[model samples]
Target: MAEQTQVHREQAGINAAAVRSAETAESTQQRLPRCRKLLFQFEVDMYAKIKTERLSFIRHNQTRLRADDYIYLHDAVADDRNANRLGNMVILPSSFTSCPRYMHERTQDAMTYVRHYCRPDLFITFTCNSKWDEISNELLPGQQSYDRHDVVARVFHLKLKQLMDYITTGAIFGAVRCHIYTIEWQKRGLPNAHILTWLWFHVPSTGSMWPAKQWFTLHERRFPIHARHPTVQHLSVHLENGQRVYFTEANLQQQLQEPRDTTLTAFFKLCTLDDFARTLLYCQLPAYYTFDASTKCWKRRVQGSSVPDHPGIYQTDALARVYTVHPNNRECFFLRIILHHVVGPVSFHHLRTVEGHVCATFHETCRRLGLLKDDAQWREALEEAATVRSPA
Candidate 1:
């Protein structure tokens, strides 16, 4: 009886080795090619769309900037109000630089608020770090350094769209209001922004001022915009000869009317969902592509077809191979569902090369729900069972 038990243990070790070897082989076969393919395709597509849309807009024959255009631009400014004073103002952390694409939108928002609320004074403040003094000295004469002037300008331009949308919509819930602030703090390795707002609302004669804690809690729940990451970059246009080039909106428009670049057009075509998916498939499968519990259905992406409702085994091992490469690849899964129809038009939404760490965590979470089998070894058995028939 002891000899038989030893024999069983030896057999189990052999089976484990074989399973590990098979998993490794399968993983290697699916990973490398998928990563290279997906990333290359996405970059090509994104470049094309930007070039086409941006360049084309520059060419249109609109000579006169209208009142509506100014209103659109004004909406980008932040809002500040004091109790009973009913003034609207915009503020930013004093390190912003530039954004050309959204100038009009910012102008519109600011103008709209001023017109409606009777031109509230703009209060610009700076959140200066200790390093500002050292950086200011190094700046060329007449150059704007990391001071309040530069920061406010950049913040106003960078977040024009969001600022305008909030104020015009009349969604003001809290007493004090804040707007966008763009800051650069890379020198200290903590570069980013924090939007600070102060709210003041009317109080009747009998009512007392609300406590700071209550005010902050309400502010957090209602006006929750704060500093985070920088979303856009400001680039300068230069001539092929390495000289700085300046062109007015009229000049850019004139150039656009003449001819369009074919290369730009082709680039956008490549960034579509199909191209992105194809690239991702070359790298890896999703780590955990299972049915969402809240949604109560398994998600699948098919070319040119809407995702179908069905029960399917979670392909965890297959997904793990791809996710081992890039963690951001998981976002592709969510994008695949939302942009199913426009996969070919969108460039950045593919999940084929995500890193396995995040994928594994997601897979384990799904496992708890019984969507995935506990052991990969059971895959073959599951496949075999699918083909077997029970005697009637």
Candidate 2:
């Protein structure tokens, strides 16, 4: 019986080694080639498109910028309701780089129409991480395994488009009023999407007073936007090279147990949900309460440190840190749905006070319409176009 057991153990070890070897071989053979092939195809497509579109002297006599024209431009601006907003507004320009080229125009049109119909509070961007190689060897059915990068990119784009359409069209964020989006291809030949949304509700501003239903509370354990270390609990805030960085050091347990330790605990709870407090505390790291060895009590450092000056009157401590439903801080129960959950590589998300992205889109649109050569011509064209109803 002892001899049989020893033989079985040796056999199991051999099988494990064989499996590891096979996995290593597969990783080297499959992953590297797929990435390389995708990259190569992207480079070729980008070069081809640039040569055909950017440098093409083919005069598109069309006086107005079409939805399809904005599909590939780095910056695309639209006049009318789809125009980006100014002030403390939230704009989500989400891009999916996996949709088909032919579908871009129709998708853009449908999104604009829906945005006009629904009228939501703000826009949020959506991106999906690709898993083409995991799903199948060939990019498409009937193509050679190694030679399907183009088809794979196209199919992936289409899949993302379908997903976004279902979600934005009254699935997740409720009714959207007006929105605009763009689809662009990457250096790797994969398609990416940029979607803008405006909902029926107005996202509450930090300084202004609004109805109670416009805001909600956020807990630290539920939404952890703070920087915390477990092994070394003692935290100090200081500025270095114009950036907020965290440092940990060994300290006596007695000092940590004092009231000073509670500052971080309490501040983080407020910081996560308080946009106004967050802005004040952003780059300016305030000093925390520290135990003076002689005094034997907590004493806050007096380096001109002050409490956050919020604009509106807070009813309670909980109400002071109330936050509106923004994409980056969006949470459902104990789970963070957007920031912590969504998987995508190329994306941008933040709260904006100005429409900084609008100029680039406007200029690109003008250039494409051949109105960029002369300022007089461009101004005249825009003035003439303003008289007519804006494009759908």
Candidate 3:
């Protein structure tokens, strides 16, 4: 009996030791860092390549213009420049402008008059979808489901940081003052963004510079229609007080109002996870122009066009063009943002139009100025211009 009791005790001790070892192993597995797992699951090298491609697109297009031009247009104005130009440049408002007191009063009166004659029905609906489920099957098999929105938001964050870094590094240097607001929106099934921006600059006084006629004259131009309007016109005027004020109008109503708290607003402020996702999209997925080997030139790829019911990317008739990357496939990430449709006070006479006329003119001008050699590509670029579409 003594021997039997001793044997039983030994067996219990072994069992306990085995249980403790198993528990320790389980805990270690649970507590392991996820970095290695994620690295193994997703092709980190491929992701890095994607990031490189995105950055390359920005560098390619942005570098085509003089750095001074970008800095002058996109940065803050120096005080000296402001003083010399007599403050003929002012910041423009964004898309979220509301009615002023006078306009509000007029609107109220008009509503009261119309309300008595007609009744309108109003309705609102809310919809939601899981980002993971929407994109899971699109990912490689055995790959973990990551949120597409989140990935885009992360990309934007990185891009913003890079832009800031570039500015600080003196890669972009100028005297103009500017502010940018990135807004994101995902309501119902639609998800997109708006970048509310303000810029203040000064033009050197040549005595012939007239604020009212030469400066304040806003021209009808085409701009990107990210949200509502397809085109916009922007202008600025010098006031008697030596301050320049800018404005934008569409259909007799101002579209550039004060910035509002849209999804993009929240994202820039880091107020919500949704914003982070948007930031990612902005940084990672900015549209760019890519060289089409088959076409033997650059072309624009629409984002997310592979999705059902998506309208393919359209070419414009305007001089300046904004290109975007097609969101559906990774191969066509470098898309162009044709600036032709953009509405602003500045004349796009220098920009090449798709109709090939402006480009031909530019090439001739460059030749006259001894700036460019007569190359075959110039003719090719001109031949491609006839395809741009003007806004109706």
Query: Can you write out model 3's per-residue Cα lDDT over 14-56, one digit (the tens) per residue?
Result: 5455334323134565321234345434444444444454444
- Rank all candidate structures by their TM-score, best first, as comma-separated numbers: 2, 3, 1
Q: Is candidate 1 or candidate 2 better by lDDT?
A: 2
The lDDT of each candidate is: 0.30, 0.33, 0.29
Error of 3 at 359 (Å): 48
Off by over 4 Å in 2: 1-123, 132-148, 185-190, 201-392
Candidate 1 at 97: error in angstroms?
14
- List TM-score per model, in order: 0.18, 0.24, 0.18
Where does the lowest 10-residue lDDT sum fall in candidate 2? Answer: 223-232
Model 1 per-residue lDDT at 68 = 20
